[model samples]
Every structure is written in C-alpha cells, then in structure tokens.
Target chain A: DTAVSQTPKYLVTQMGNDKSIKCEQNLGHDTMYWYKQDSKKFLKIMFSYNNKELIINETVPNRFSPKSPDKAHLNLHINSLELGDSAVYFCASSHSFGQRAYEQYFGPGTRLTVT
Target chain B: TQLLEQSPQFLSIQEGENLTVYCNSSSVFSSLQWYRQEPGEGPVLLVTVVTGGEVKKLKRLTFQFGDARKDSSLHITAAQPGDTGLYLCAGLKGSNYKLTFGKGTLLTVNP
Candidate 1:
C-alpha cells in the first residue's frame, strides 16, 4: 500500500491563477509537512502541522497556505501563483514530534508549473 | 537557522566503484537521517542515526554519525547503476521535529 500519497501529480497553471494540491497519508502519523523543491533541487520545509495544529511556519509568503483537515490529511493552496512557484511540492508525515529517531515518509510529489 | 552542508555536490563514477558522501553542520543535532531520491520521485529514508559516533550498515551501504552529532557520512561499496540518485542528509535539533536538510549530493553511477 502507498503509505503517503498526493493528488494532482502534475499541475500546470498560468500566472495569477490559484491552485491547490491534496495530500493524504495512511501511516497514522500525527505530524504532516509540506516541502518545496526548487529548480536547483534545494528542498525546504514550508509548513508543518501536528494533529491538525499548525506548528511550524517558515518564512514563506502569505500567498501559500497549508490546511490540515485532520491528522491524516494536509493540503497546500497557492494564491496568485507566480513563475517562482513552479516547483515540486512534496508531502511528508511522521509519527510524532520531538523524537530522536523520527522518520518521515514522503509522497510521490506534485510538479507545479506556473506559466 | 541550522544548516547541513553536503560536500562534492555532484559525483560521477563507474560501476563497482566505491564512494563516500559527507554531511556537515556546525550546530549539533539530536538525530540525523539520510535519504535517497530518484528522478521524479520524493526522497526515501535510507537510515537514521541518533547516537553519537554510531555506525549502521545496510548491505553494501554504511552510515556513520559523528562523535559530536554535528556531522555524518554515508559510504557505499561497489556502487551499481541502481545507486545513482540524489543523496540528502537531514538533521533534527532538540525538541524540534523540523528537519534541516542539506543541499544534497547527486551521484551518478555509469555502467
């Protein structure tokens, strides 16, 4: 079974358009995260939610918002998509927070292209 | 902000060759993790090291955590074409579950 899965694996939209990427994990994890991998392949964490509570919010722009309806799902919504928003978005989940050996499971990733 | 820096951003070698990738950071961490990502896919965890000066082996791959918990290394013996991918190292600080990831080292094993 796919432990972590993401929908809309490929999203292509024009500038100023809005888009959303859905993510779900069956690992029964308490924490879920959203990451962005730019063209240079630098992966950076944008947001993290623990049991549907926002825990970490990096210095990302307000245009990007992450919503977790429950502990099993986390979704990212982008407003006024720009060319710089074109990158791969990955969803990840972990069992809990503050564990020394916490391992995160990642989804297949969604490639977003903002034209 | 804590940052992990991986050395030799890119490596290209022939099959059967051995290589070692380094992940270094100035800030100490409670744990370190190594991941391998293939093209068009998300990264998959290879191993996690929690103790200082700890070493773990998975077949031909060996992972070592630094004594100070600020660095780590991954050694692959007799690499095959399947080993070609992007290798990333992530560190976790005390009480912070967020991971600080390195830029990653891209390894290309040619047959």
Candidate 2:
C-alpha cells in the first residue's frame, strides 16, 4: 500500500486557470505539509497543518490556499494560476510536529504546468 | 530566515567510488535530517542527527553533525548504481518546527 498518495500527478492548464491537488496519507500521521519545487529545484515549504489546523504559512501569494478537512487529507487549491506557478508540488506527512515527529513521508509530487 | 545550503549541487561518480555531500546553515539547529529522493518519487529519510558532533552509520552510509550544529555531511562508501539519487538536508532550528531544506545534491552513479 502506498504510504502517501497524491492525485493528478501531472497537470497542464492555461494561464489564469484554477486547479487543485489532493493529498492523502494512511500512516495515521497528524502533521501534513505542502512544498513547491521551482525550476531551480529549490524546495520551499508553503503550508503545514497539524490535525487539520494550520500551523505554518510561508510567504506564498494569496492565490494558493491549503485546506485540511481531516488528519488524513490535505488539499491545495490554486486560483488564477499564472505562468510562474509552473512547478512540482509535493505533499508530506509526519506522526507529530517538531522533534516529536520521526520523519516526513512524502507523496508522489504533482507536476503542474501553466502555459 | 533559517536556511540550509548544500554543496556540489551535482555529483557524477563511478560505481565503487566514495563521495561526500555537505549541508551548511548560518543558523544553529537542534536537529538535522538527511533524505534521499529518486526520480519522479518522493524523498525518503536516510538519517537524522540531533546532537553536535554526533555520527551515525547505516550500512554503507555515514552521517555526521557539526559540533556547532550548523552543518552536516553524508559520506557514502563503495557507492553503487542504486545510490544515485538527490540527497537533501533539512534543519529544525530552535523553537521552530518547520523544516528548511537545501537545494539538494544530485548524485549520479555510473556503472
């Protein structure tokens, strides 16, 4: 069984379009995160949630928002996506927050292409 | 902002060779972790070093944390083709739970 799974492994949409990436994990973890890897391959943390509560919010633009309805799910929704939004988005989960969390288990990344 | 910096962004080595990847940061961290990611796949945890000057060994991989808690390194011995992947270092600084990652070191082991 896959530990962490993401939907729409590949996404191609036009500029100004809206898209969403869904992530789920069955490891019974409480903390989940969203990271973006740009063309330069720099992985930046965008958001993090612990048991459906928002914890970290990086300096991401307002167009991107993350929602966690439950402990097992964290969804990313991007509105009015622009060409600059073309990058790979990843979802990750851990058992807890901070040092208490053993390690992060990542899901297959979603490659988004905005043309 | 706390950030981790990885050296030798790209590495290409022959099988049975040895290599080392370094991760440094300007800020001190309470704990540091190393992760390996394959193409088109998510990263997997390789090791985590918490104490300053701590060294951990896993099979052919050796990880060490700097005494100042501001740097770490991963040394692989007799690297095989299976060892080719992107190695990333993440740091958890004092009072901060978020992981600040480095750009990563991409290793290509040629047979």
Best lDDT among the predictions, by candidate number = 1
Return the top candidate by TM-score. 1
lDDT of 1 by residue, A26-113 (tens): 9889999999999988999999998899999999999999999999999999999999999999999997744523588999999999
Q: How close is candidate 2 to the true structure, as a TM-score?
A: 0.96
Q: Specify the poorest-scoring 10-residue window by lDDT in model 2 chain B.
A: B91-100
DockQ of predicted model 1: 0.83
Q: Candidate 2, which CAPRI tier? A: medium
Scored by DockQ, the top model is: 1
Model 2, B1-111: lDDT tens digits are: 537889899999999999999999888988899999998888899988999999999999999999999999999999999999999999887644488899999999999
- When summed lDDT is taken over every stretch of 10 residues in candidate 1 chain B, the lowest stretch is B91-100
Give lDDT for model 2: 0.91
In order of appearance, the predictions have TM-scores of 0.97, 0.96
Candidate 1 per-residue lDDT, tens place, B32-101, comes to 9999999999999999999999999999999999999999999999999999999999998875668989
Docking class for candidate 1: high
Question: For model 2, which pairs clash?
Answer: none
